[model samples]
Target: MQKLLEIKELTVSYDHEVVLNDVNLTVHKGDFLGVIGPNGGGKTSLIKAILGLVKPSKGQILFHIPQTRIGYLPQINQIDKRFPITVLDVVRSGKTDRRSFSLFAKQTEEIAHAESLLNEMGVWQLRHKAIGELSGGQMQRVFLCRSLMNRPELLILDEPDTFVDNQFESELYEKLKELNQRMAIVLVSHDVGTISYYVKTIACVARELHYHPSNIISTTQLASYNCPLQIITHGDVPHTVLGLHDKHQHDHKHDHEHDH
Candidate 1:
């Protein structure tokens, strides 16, 4: 459980508009950390900060590796499918940033690694297929394979399940579980209920930092975790009976109408 990354009082802004404020977090080796919150909750910004893609206005982000092999799988929805790129081409792009033109002159090894990753993700059948031709789930798997080609020590994914179905999601989680045995993973997701089973730690972000240990999260702890206040009920019951107050007093009016 050695610390791999640490952020202290991190603050990020875009065009002078504050997005993240006083954020703090710690990630350990072999940890599966899930970041959950509503849309526009600065989850992506936080990940970018950790990856050194976005510079924090204040505070610090300390990493264990000066040249870390970090893998990134951005939200699939953000990708332009009309780019006319093949799956193998997409996976090969991962090496372009690391391999120099001279080094790539004889890059059979890199090509083989990319093919192996595609096969591992069960997408080798579509290696030559155009990215736009693949289904959403297939496209996600392809990107995941590309991310893994770097042999990263830390993998960061933003909304990995956006376009995938339940079955594919299950497969993705299984792959992630296997990958977690080798590298630490940080995932930003809105699917909190599903991610709880896979992630060892949860970081709830909403203009601040709130860490939860795991699935044993309590209602009070959730509230303190910067999660919005939501009244959860076990069974169907009248709102009036639940003691939830409404400014218009609609529950009382509904009860009065029903009594007639």
Candidate 2:
């Protein structure tokens, strides 16, 4: 696949301490990359770096396309629900690709585009409804449509499933899976279980960045990276059993490994 974004020896710092050190990764065409790690880790820093929100102290970020449309949904939204904003209005607020804006001007095309995305998200019927009146899941769908309004080449989401209902959580993933056919994705979350299943690859970010080729990371593998993450997995696996005479050691040695 063609490479879209590349980060080499990227380091982000605040004050004198380094948030991310010697971080490196590449985003390829149609790549759905999931970033998982601890709270204080530099997961958000990586995203901000890629999005050009934070200046890297050192290293280089090369974008294949000089002007790639990006859709971003942060973990915390600053939307004031108390304000009177309709679903269409919310979707319209994200149309950054337009050349000009005139309220009285003919915006039929833009309106149709927003409506189409709203319908795809199953919220077209609520287009006229106030954002404050909608449920959490419904509001999330509205934000999703807003993010998608620009038809971004890369979609960057930070814990998109935070306030969404459990049912829509899977539904949203399904939608994103279908959308991944055309665009690349980068998602940051602490939810290992669902992200492992949906994303094509996983990057475990601690003080440094470790890109795992596959999502099937063993609990031991996490410990080896000194990554303090909870591994949540499903299925029937036999637990280790020791005979009465056998000895099991609780002490484990972690192999220091690079992501490569």
Candidate 3:
């Protein structure tokens, strides 16, 4: 309920191209925010600025809690398949991010915690299996366990559903909803309409940013912000929002531009 994070007059640029422009936002405790935008949009840049991964061209990002209370799951976790790490080993790695805790000495309590998290993620049976042997969705579950191992108050997930499958898609959001009861969440994804049902608010990022306060949004509302995504929502069965008409229009425009 209290203000947790604030982004004021935020701007990020790469060689004057201007990836993000004068963005401003406020995040409160228990906020479940879904960030959606096109591929070349400034979603990644905006996230980087918030996490302090990249220097902002201008403005400020302030966090109410200690930086250690935040946990980040990057978009591409390019781990070498030959590294020979186990599922438990990867989950335990999250402990290293918390410098206050001792990394080397393993306590019986910590091992128990790791196993509990792995079981919750449905990968407890594969605890000792090589990470490379697991499927994409399985690996995502493992990384999620790792991210949550530290009990962070603010979790930032950049495209958490990238390599995820249909079965785990709903499950992941359900888990996130449960987690949101305790902490705040920021989820960045290309699937806007799908996430709209789960997130409390929607933030669309292009070169600029548009914040919609609720999950139920009209196509016109998105158009007002010049957001290019076409999201179709259903009142009964929740299905994918992207429409074929939008795709055809986009492709046609691309070909037209190529002709010139």
Runs with alpha carbons beyond 4 Å of true place in candidate 3: 77-82, 97-106, 232-260
TM-score of each: 0.83, 0.83, 0.85
Off by over 4 Å in 1: 96-106, 229-260
**Superior by TM-score: candidate 2 or candidate 3:** 3
| Segments in model 2 whose C-alpha atoms lie over 4 Å from true places | 66-68, 99-106, 233-260
Best TM-score among the predictions, by candidate number: 3
Model 2 agreement with the true structure over 1-260: per-residue lDDT tens digits? 79888999999999968999999899888888888889889888888898899999999899985444788877746567888889998998888777655854537767888999999999999999999999988888889889887888888888887888778888888898888988899888887766766777778899798886664455666666666787553332111211111112122111112121
What pairs collide in candidate 1? none
Residue 11 of model 2: what lDDT? 93
**TM-score (C-alpha, index-matched) for candidate 2:** 0.83
Q: List the pairs of residues colliding in candidate 3.
A: none
Ranking by TM-score: 3, 2, 1
Q: List, residue by residue over 8-106, the lDDT tens digit for candidate 1.
A: 999999998889999988888888888887788899999889878899999998888533478899988789999999999899887634644566563
| lDDT by residue (tens digit), candidate 3, 1-260 | 69888999999989987889999999899889999888888998888887788899899999998776787777755556567899898888876444444544555556787889999888899999989899878888888888887788888898987877867777888889998988899999888766866887788898889987665455666777877886644333243232222334433321212210
* Per-residue lDDT of 181 in model 2: 86
